[model samples]
Target: METLYRKYRPKRFSEIVGQKHVKTLFINSIKNNNVSHAYIFAGPRGTGKTTIARILSKSLNCENRKDAEPCNVCNSCISIDKGNFMDVLEIDAASNRGIDEIRKIRETVGYHTAQGKYKVYIIDEAHMLTREAFNALLKTLEEPPSNVVFILATTNPEKIPQTIISRCQVIDFKNIPLKDIVDRLEFVCQKEKFNATKDALIEIAKRANGGLRDALTILEQVAKSSKNNIDINDVRNTLGLVSEELIDNLLKNIKEGNIINILKIIDEVYYSGRDFETFLFQTIEKILLLIEENNNTEFINLLKPLSDILKDIKYSEEKIILVKLGFLNLINFKENNNKTTNKVLENIKKESEKIEENIESEKTEVMEKDIPKFDEVLEDLKINGDLSLYIGLSFAKIQEGSDKIKLIFPYSKKLHFELIKDKKSFLEQYIKRKFGITKEIEVILSNSTEDETLKKLSFLFGKNYKIEGD
Candidate 1:
């Protein structure tokens, strides 16, 4: 019996799945009667390279082609579909990649068509052709036969010589979009009257990773294994993949610092024979989505630890231990950050009070009239949702100048200075909001040898008060 992918392979341009761009080029070319002599179809596996090549062959020789689509009922289309067409030839370059094969093709392209308007050579896996064979075919590709069409399809276009590439119109076939793959699977199920949950179809599509043909193959395998009532659980069981729900639970516990639940989940995954790398990768992907799309920094602390764990996996066979250590590092880092924030907040509060006290006692003309207190800057950062920036800025001191407000970072904190320098516009905006006009702010890395910086910062509080903290 024929497989589902082969049985439902696109017979016409309209039935070809994704890659709107590729379809447009051929459609426009056919409409204007200006088809090229040689074309290169390049991209990933199972992504409609050979499929589109065959469709283009059929369209070129199609007796009643309309709007770049072959009339499937015509004798020319039928012979091409049956692989019996005299003028349309499909060669598997992987097997026939030699000078002999190129010699035959060079001889064949020079002849007149036996039955069709043009002779089409569809070469699948064109990259596998030997270098000498490519050199022999280069002249034919360069000075294309007026009546011949050469379609070179390959998964790796880089292997094909540039001389061959420059002679052809290169059309890249991309991975079919997930939604399109699912829609195609749904249509297949509806046609076959096979029952499947939408979640099951989606899971199949995700695992296919943008390959429509591979998605159909997976769907067919699952359908064969099931009693026509396939659901999400059926997919998980058959594919031996980690459960999405279980991964979510693991992430939730990690974020809440629930070390016990995290251990249970890790143990369950390890003992049940699921892949640790797969589970880790899926969990990391979920966290990345949260950070990128939602801007949720709850698990941002784990990125470094998780990255280290991933690197450690390559060197050590003790993956489970490394994974556990990585998760433990997450909570430890989170708690340490909380401690650091508390310490910084405490020091800022104390410093603000002391500066206010000295201002009332001595009536300092500089700080009381010019810039905001340090605590006020920290408060604005907290209220405005710039946690990482706030933390980066916490290491530095704000220096009020006659022409500019300089953010001074001690030489030891040059990394923080570099990180915070990207937000120069935001700091300038803060200065403008506080002082009623825009002011330039410069990030200055102070010399570490310059007497500890505690004395140089006396302009903020008073000549008597010299404050510093890491």
Candidate 2:
């Protein structure tokens, strides 16, 4: 059976949706009698480039057409719509992309139209044309016979040479919007007398990702599977799409650090016949959105380890990891039921909580520490290092100090201490070398006391060291 999308593919320029700019240009060109000999239509697949090309050919040859619009009732229009138009030659450049093909086309270009006013050559996937083929066609494209019109279509315009592109009027087609796809699908459902919910149509449109052909294909699949009233759930099941609720549940489990629940959800999704690669992609997309929202950086950080798992495009490997590690913990509910999984999950959750607690406790301890004032420490160091180089190390303090000199470090106590310990002796020697005198250096760790450091830093490095508080 012909799918709804194919069955209802636009037959005329007016029927093509969401490409007003291209349509307007073509219509105006025909009206103004300024039509180019060749045109290059490029964009994503199923964006109606080929359809528009055929329609334009019909309009050019139609017995009756308004401006550039094809009169669908005319023999020329009907033949073109049915792909039987003699003067409208459609070539699949992917299969016929060689110098020989170009020679054949060049030979045909010299001949007048057999049955139409202008002979039209439509080369789909024009980017596939070899360099020789493109070069051979360049002269004809630039100065084709008055009776010949060339329409070149490609998904990737970047592959086509600038020389070829310069000879043709380029029209870029954009992906059809989701709302437009849904509206069209709904219209198709009405025409076919099939009950379809808005939600179902929207789901199909989203899965189609702005491709009208794919959306219609999915819609046709669902229509065949469903007897009446296509619901969102029906669309999900028919398309094997993981449910948003399920995705939400998985995200919640990951956010709560419930590894067991996460595993269980993975198992459930797998058992429900969802592709693991799809799941991984969906998970990655969801995580990216969460990261954008700034609501779950910690969860994002935790999932960073799974980057390798997401890197593989093969489904089998993804399925293995998702089924074994992600879902295995959730599936053992029958033995210990939810109890065992919950216990393990809870344990992991507690460990994460404990780690967070430890971090907080450390922070509090640092805050309570009796660290030296920033001005005093800055005076002791005397701005020895280039301030610009060390400016990013904003939060510095002293771990240990004396009246003669002070030890300087970063706010992150460990890094600060480590850096001081590593560079202390070298820095001291370097300073002494620069000053031509021995200098006593004290090492101090910088905790979260950034304001004090900034005040003293401004004194040593001038107003340029004025630090902004977060």
Q: Which candidate has the highest TM-score of all?
A: 1
Give a tens-digit lDDT track for model 2, residues 1-470. 77676789897777887898988888898889777899999999888888888888888899988767878898888888888888999999999998998899888888867787889999999999999999999899989888789999999999999999998889899999988888899888899888998888887888887788888888888888988679999997887778778888876765555777776776787788887767766677677778788776644643543455555435454556644553333333223544777887886676567557655765564454364444333334557654532432233433434433455554445555666556657756754565454556666665555433453455357776544679
> How high is each candidate's TM-score?
0.70, 0.67
For 354-444, candidate 1 gives per-residue lDDT tens digits of: 6566445433422243356545666778787588778777666677666676777766567888988989898778757875656677888
Off by over 4 Å in 1: 94-100, 301-322, 325-350, 363-470
lDDT of 2 at 379: 37
lDDT of 2: 0.75
lDDT for model 1 comes to: 0.82
Clashes of 1: 0
**Model 2 lowest lDDT segment of ten:** 389-398
Off by over 4 Å in 2: 285-308, 313-318, 322-470
